[model samples]
Target: MMALRLRAQHRGFHSRRPSRARDVARVGRVNPPAIRVVAIAAACILGLTAATFPADEVHWTITGQNSVTVDWRGGDAEVRYGTTQALDRRVEAVAPEPLPFSSRGPFREAKITGLDQNTLYYYSIGGGPLHTFRTPPPRGGSGFTFYVQGDIGGSLDWKHVAECQALIAEGRPDFVLCVGDLTYGNSVGQHAVDTHFNDVMRWSLDAAYMPAWGNHEWDKPRSDDLRNYKGRFDLPNPQSSPADRRYPYTGGGEDWYWFDYGNVRFVAYPDPWSGAWADWAQRAEEVMAEAEDDTAITFIVTFGHRPAFSSGEHEGEPELQGFLGTLRARNPKLVLNLNGHSHDYERTYPQGGVVHVTAGTGGSNLEEESGSGCPWRGGCPEPPWSAFRAMHHVAVRLHVENDRIEGTVYCGPAGGGGSNTNDIACAQGSVIDSFTIYPYGLKPGAPKPPSEEEEEAQAKKPAPGR
Candidate 1:
């Protein structure tokens, strides 16, 4: 098989950082919502080739107010950075870190500390081109935009993933959530590892990313597991890993973890394919119990690779159903749930007021809402819970704020101009689904199920208009 020497052509990098509220301290604590989103669209674009040498394989991760991790291809070099475009200060250069077993090349990492939140900074590795990333706002900031994506970086999905990456860069979210399935072809091998990183180098370097394991990452010892997943990214709250469970079974992220970005608290569960649902459930219960008094937490959100509720062809996950059901029992007013794996875009009606969203359209082939039936223990159907389902390659965008949180599902067309610039880049396709969440006085628990007699009485009652 002939390898494709990848490259994208574009001018100097562009960044539209999130505007921090003047009173960041006061804004983030509002008892209302998380992130505010204006609109959603998925305009597909291809032909993303633009960049010079040295900068080609550079990217940053684990970015917070006072810390950041930069990974670049070079012999051995320290990082130099500062607030201005010209990097005047420099961190002592260090030897290149060992690459994942299957990966090849002299890639190194530099951990830079002492940064201010909501401030824009520029840095370069070993005197390379100046790259930029904005750290998330302090604990309580009005809220900012973040992107959630999954099921990308495969042979067939390569171009689409690259395009999606381009689109992501265009948005310049404060941070991003990678919902697993980083790469498909030999996820841990040299070819797959290199391809995956290079594909996103265009945009990933501009935004901080938090990665979750997917079925493609597999279940193995933490050191050698998930191939480059662990090797690539880190989270702000790494110690909150729920999978540790006194035993700390490090197979694909301790099976679960949680972190607070700005005012939102994000809880991620283990991949259903990893066979770690038991751990995830335990963790979910623990967090919910804590949520009752955790005033620091403005929003309680959950994420994972498989969906307990989906209207696609891929089989459903009973574990997810059990996992989320636990949250419902514990925290009925759960704000949101993000998921992927069933390559399609799906939004479920608020089940007792929590939105469960499936966003597997991150460059994978779209699964049609066909009659193929989902193969879960009970089976999958367009349950009354399904609000919308579409077969379009797309990405999920969320805007967080103090009082109200909004979400938009953007679907790209089956075909469009093959370029990642101009209208194609900002192409806001029609919004297929959108939802809002309120944090203040959210019901503590699910409403008691109506009795059969009460249900009959309600049914006998006249309609709203009547």
Candidate 2:
């Protein structure tokens, strides 16, 4: 797989204002044309400089079972790698091409393929720093952990930045699954993408990061145009690529895609707020049908930026509510639905054989009504599907194994604002919510492990068919 080519010129490079009076004067004296020429020359020599995230801290996207796409802000599009941390082997990445304006910089990406499955490999970008990554397990292999969150970026008071650092240092998730609301960019531009990448670079440096479009991603000043989002991330292009469509796709570029890991198949589609409802629904139906026919797939997880069922300030999308209700009716393998946009954490009771989880607590301001269901601002009663809710910032970790999928919601420090609000305060790094789902062979309400007393009582009872 070739790395995605730079499609447009961007100004993602962070420009620092001259601080000293003399420095400012010097900069002011420089001519625009001269500055442009100098910048172009520098870019030609050193590659575009990513002021926010250094080239060494590369952003990763899992493109296939044997390949991963690594992108960096400013550097030679070169990656050297091998199975060992020594990086004895190497591969030259595609060099960055020049854009129209010399002042703007282009994001450099390289697609590394032909890697050994389930093997640990160490790589360095432009010989900057040594980083390690593990490929997805071989087909049918089932033992991995991935993190999930949404609403990352912005709201410094929310502690998302620090929270993310801790997640990587301790949890070290294999990859990240984000439900959207990625950057709180007020507009559609490089600065917005830069700010978001800066906030999450720590996680991106270590693990493959996959995201679905959220309202904040597309509902910006340049509405409906996801050039930045699409250009930055190289998602699985199952429909467009010549390879057999492993799963159904709506042919929306990175707007939607699907991939598999171990026994789980993850399908990311757009919600009504992000894309056409009918188009995405059609893809969802196709994926469900495929999963139903493939007996090897033990779990089917779908995620997006907007929630199909959420009690946060934004509430749930009414169109999604109906579509999901029907989708889950016939697809039991579609056990989990992940989403964000509510600015809180919520888990629904098994509704129509599937559990919908809203994990919008990834930084950003905490909504009083998020997960609370009371709608501190006032409205209709809480929906019956809501099982667990919390206003604290959090990131979820899912342990996907052969028989079950276990999830643990790890909470971060409470955001600013005194205790008078509806937000729940919890010790940072505490597990606020946890649950297990047996998607293959278990009764509907049979999730959540039984208590010791219940287990003991069952043991005392006679065996079945005795």
Candidate 3:
């Protein structure tokens, strides 16, 4: 295979000391337009010459407020990074420890720590193309955006996945919040995982990826194992994994983790199939409780594979609903619950003080609505809490500001068989849904709910016609 190389355009090198403004400005230049120009130029160069570089499946993992873990395969054990395009700093990369009875990985991880917060750094592995990534700002920073999706990646659904990837690249988000079913490890095996890692290398070039586990990540009954899924992707808080009663298994490394990006406390709750669902639920609540006490945290968002309430074919998970509803009812800071597993797009009407979005429309067999009663912890009407439902491949981009959270759902090609089985078009990508939610309460200048006595007096008053 031919290899591509990106030389540092600027040759100036700075001292050990770093300048925040200079670095941040350089970081802003890594936007989509500049990247497109660079990619086109690289393509032209690739047609004329080829080089041999073994590094493949390169990606970034946000490990902490000031740290990021970079992973790749078949590269020299060294990484070069710096605040400037000159790429002056260096770190030695090492292979991840092998897991017993799982896929033997040659994945190498290099954790860059103690870096400046919210600053951009350019890096390269073994003299490869220069890549860039931005560290998240301090906890209360609130101007960033990220993408969320799940049930992504399949051999047959490559077109949909590719289209979704294009949208992600164009937006150039700070990171991607992967809710689960990333590569369908149970169905497609190691090849699928590797392919996904490579496919993500492009769009995730400057964005950190945070993942939650899905049921497909664990191969149940056969080996009851998390094969390649565990071997790849370095996640935060692996040692905090709760004990599983069933197979002496602990694939909850990536599933049970949380991080504060900007003012939002993002929590990745364990997948429901983990056998220790109740324990995990308690743990998730504890995380929220902690976030609630932190003044820096303005909103809390929880995500996992299975949906607590969905209009799609799969039955709602009452167990999850019970846990999430309790959080929403008690904590006003709990704003959104993201999920997948139903294989369609659904957005609830802020049921129980939280907006629920089921974005399982990412490159898998689309599921139609099940006509069953709307499932909520305290009972909901027949039409369901779902405000919008569709059978199209889609992903949501959330713009989180200090006061409100804005979201836009972008649709892609036909999820399955390239036909519009549902009313919504499965054709070109476009914005299908848009919404805004004020985390603190009603938006500014919005009217407040009336008191009981005032409501009673208003109710007693007849209509003007009457």
Candidate 4:
């Protein structure tokens, strides 16, 4: 398959002969104003040099699980990494094949493996001049923190992007999880994708960005979305069953995959955008079931474009409802559901178990209330299942400790305070809600495992809708 085959092309160099003094004299004699022309040429060259000397904008992303992938845009892709600032080592890696759209549309990506677990590796991308990232430790190791946000695009609110960058700088997360809808491509064209990343690079200092697929990314067709996503990011494509070379074992088909970092298992799945959630639902269930055997898999978090339950403007899609139901049925331990598409923030608790939180307000304008009967709206009066609901700009932060996992839903700075409120404008940067989940057997008198009756009750509850 084209995805698996690694094709490297070498561009042959042909040097040009240097101009000699005789040639210069001949040109000068033939010109009516050689001195003037030389002066003009020198001025133009100086201007060009000044224009090109601006601090270069650097873009790099981190992917893969135990083995991390680093890619940079706007310059050569290389790495000078080590534990100290000296960066005593250097390694050359292949640059990613050019992808269509803009000059920087498709950034290059490379995988760095054979590293120790729970150890920090400071590496610079594009060799040395610029760009760098810190590799995250494998799962079940020392605890670490990462930032999570979604639905950020180049158009609309650029300040939100700035806020996100400031948050990253403050938190200094090992990495960032951009849930989805990164580019406002749903209304625009492919060019928007490049613009989106350019905006991100402007704000992103040194954080490793990992993105999921959103519906806006499906501008042309499902295949186009896959191509653009793959072309832009370096992700793991698990070799399909030992027999099939075409389809890889990656979780969500194209952008779907699983990775471990500091006692947490992150499963990124493709949203139902390409009409493949049914198939993905089954695969995801299987992966979760197998993960049950490993006690270390304490936190099971999934990210996609659509939310299982939301109170925002686009909440009532039947397919989304079904997908959420299936996902909840399959993975009871699913602690968080990160999404982006609604352009607002919301958090919903499972009727019986599971906590469904939506961080779709990453810079995108706040979506008007759909007035649908979801938990976000007042329609449900008192949702038996929902623990907290808000309509505002915000992100979710997960802090994984040795024995417990703590989560805080952070609203935008504009939001009045760190308190929950139905007012969307007053919900920014506020600690709308906070919760913690302990290991199954670690805490005494913890809630018992849901019985079949409780599971049935959860399945029968009204799902989120438009």
Candidate 5:
């Protein structure tokens, strides 16, 4: 694996910001041209090169209970797992499947499934040192935690992203809900996409990252990034959108996927522009509606690149509005709806017993809360539906317990650069917002584990599709 290069954190030099008033004044006095020249040199130094890729760049994903999907860049990849760090067992190397429309290598996936539940497993990829992940206790068991964020990318705000990722590493969530836009200015080609994946590779140490497709993942003209997303990620996407070809500006392939982890049912929807809206909405409705009757699922968490409800400059989407309407119509007690694209943090009131949250401020330049329809700032009054909104960057931490899921939005510093996870994740300091989903219909009753026949049938049954 290539060395983890954290921008602005090189070892030879100490990087510091103007912390004092006089220092800030001195920084203000610096010429813009000098800054641009230094920035250009730094960018050129970090420019994407095939040499920067790990000989065996690897990452992991959670497909289902006791199941994980390991994807690597280099071919002829192998994985080893056992109860201990010294892996005594090995899964033979397997060839990757080629993309449907490209020549940029193949999607190498090795699935480690059918393991014991409520147990920790140690594993390694491509002869790397062993890493660890725990099979979540069967749905509704205690001690469950997860982080949610989106619009996270590399190259632009490397220091900020690194700090947030470090915070998540410390929390050690079972899995990460990466709503969408996992890459940005760094997403130039397939290799760049993989490099972007490797940027957050540290989070995969203890948590399986489950990501969705965002608009930025679609590179127009050639659409190589779309091919890269399909070729790089092996999610449990039983649903397919054939009408993806109808969208002229986007690329397509199994962007919508879902999985059950712990007591939560997670669904990842695609960017609306990529395919048929009607088809996508119907699929979303089915997923949410079906959860209403699922007693074992104590919480429902759905995410995507764009938010169905937001208060940022984007102000949310009508497509999501209709989808939420459908979900409300079905009366499923959804715990949280996670989304990105607004570049800020926002939470909606418990309208019809569902809370909608937007945590798009992951490393991207913060978008001021100018268009959330607030009448003022600092202590503004949001509309009846919007509970909280902020322009600062934040990542949402959800602590799922028996009857309630408490959430804390860890706000980052004034500007991008950050030093420690403590500042990025705490009840004080940068932490600004918090919310809770009480024992709504979803979490009230004691969980009854889904029957074996039902789980088996659903696994074999295809998700509703167009």
Candidate 6:
């Protein structure tokens, strides 16, 4: 039955939308009264088609401290934004070209600039309905809030996905960050990715989605899977030498780039592939080392797919350990490292001064302990720098205020049932763990110069020592 469903989903990729007008006309000739009814229905359909699409899954993200990017699932990607909710007062805007309708889907995106820092603005897309978003202050005076999750592969049976969606709806975060494994394209097809987007569209109707690559993203080959991934989303690549070209290849590939929103500096790292793990690790180290100490960057957060320490059946990879070691060396307020792969939730303390969180329980099948002798598995005797661990389905809610960053893990019921239980196999809601991250070089009143202890702590430790 599951295989049949997978086949039908793959078949959908080859399907196309039919002409509604012809179908309506064909049905109208059956009877005069029916024709009259058909005419009315056709008129209504025409009106709906003309009034601009509903702009499904409307979301916003911080393009910069003073700029916000509004994106939606599909439709005329245009924004009619203003300082007032009336929308009568038009402001700066941009409209993407009409997207071609086909199974080879495309995700539309547009960035709105010239926004007032720390001010509230009302905006609407295609003259539809007005929505509101608050811009971050120019200097990062106060804090902000956002959402993060992983492995939500559009499973229709997982109740936890709906629960997490409801949590996001209530939280009303500034943006959403997905670590990896958003859609399980392995063993399935491209339709799995589409289904995942469809499910996400239902829940994330007002949140901007920031993503990192996962293993599932590379389940196929670069030619097949990479095309699907690149075609669907529009991410930032500021250092691209040739504009308008796809996949702006940087030192760490085009997908890897750095951007700043308010006081936080986010670095999106691509998953290591094709024996390039060591190269990726070295590049991450270089990027962190080049970041400024006081300006443009305050906090550094890195996200990828596989984890450095996991107790799942896959266990931890040695290449990831090398990458983590290099990343720890360039200590630029290394706040958090987010990942998804274990099909469960876990959070670790400041390992070598960096926090780690695994949020792989996003609507995927949970993997039980294989009881294998993998070093990171079988439960660490002393929790190997791990602050918290759980095998339940969950996601993380981040609240960034001023110079402090706080994160809370929202656990939901595990398994296919709806019952809420605390058992690792049963999904439930609870705060598994929480942590706060302070900006670099600023720790309240002291104002002292960089001490030797600080330098040694922040600097990369020798490879042998590590």
- The best candidate by lDDT is 3
Model 5 lDDT-worst window of ten: 6-15
Which has the better TM-score: candidate 3, or candidate 5? Answer: 3
lDDT of 5 by residue, 66-172 (tens): 77667765444567776666767667544444342332333456777887766777776655555676665776565577888886765323445656666666666
Give the residue spans of candidate 5 off by over 4 A. 1-57, 93-95, 98-107, 156-159, 185-192, 219-223, 246-253, 369-381, 416-429, 441-466
Q: Score candidate 3 by lDDT.
A: 0.65
Counting clashing residue pairs in each candidate, in order, gives 19, 0, 0, 14, 0, 11
Question: How many backbone clashes are present in model 4?
Answer: 14
Q: By TM-score, how accurate is candidate 4? A: 0.71
lDDT of residue 184 for candidate 2: 52
**lDDT of every model, 2 decimals:** 0.57, 0.63, 0.65, 0.54, 0.60, 0.55
Per-prediction TM-score: 0.71, 0.75, 0.78, 0.71, 0.74, 0.72
Q: Find the 10 residues in a row with the least total lDDT in model 4.
A: 5-14
lDDT (Cα, tens digit) per residue for candidate 4, span 305-393: 66666655455345655655555555555556667666566666543345566776666555543335342443555355556666666
lDDT (Cα, tens digit) per residue for candidate 6, span 13-42: 001121112111111111224675686488
Task: Give the Å error, residue 311, model 3.
Answer: 1.1
Task: Name the regions of candidate 3 deviating beyond 4 angstroms.
Answer: 1-52, 98-105, 155-157, 221-224, 238-241, 245-248, 369-382, 415-420, 445-466
Error of 5 at 440 (Å): 2.8
Off by over 4 Å in 1: 1-57, 63-65, 92-98, 154-157, 187-190, 219-225, 239-255, 273-275, 288-291, 369-381, 415-428, 440-466
Model 4 misses residue 429 by how many Å?
Answer: 4.5
User: Runs in model 2 with CA error above 4 Å?
Assistant: 1-57, 94-103, 154-159, 187-190, 223-225, 238-252, 273-275, 369-382, 418-422, 440-466
TM-score of predicted structure 3: 0.78
Cα RMSD, each candidate: 14.8, 11.7, 13.0, 15.1, 11.1, 12.0
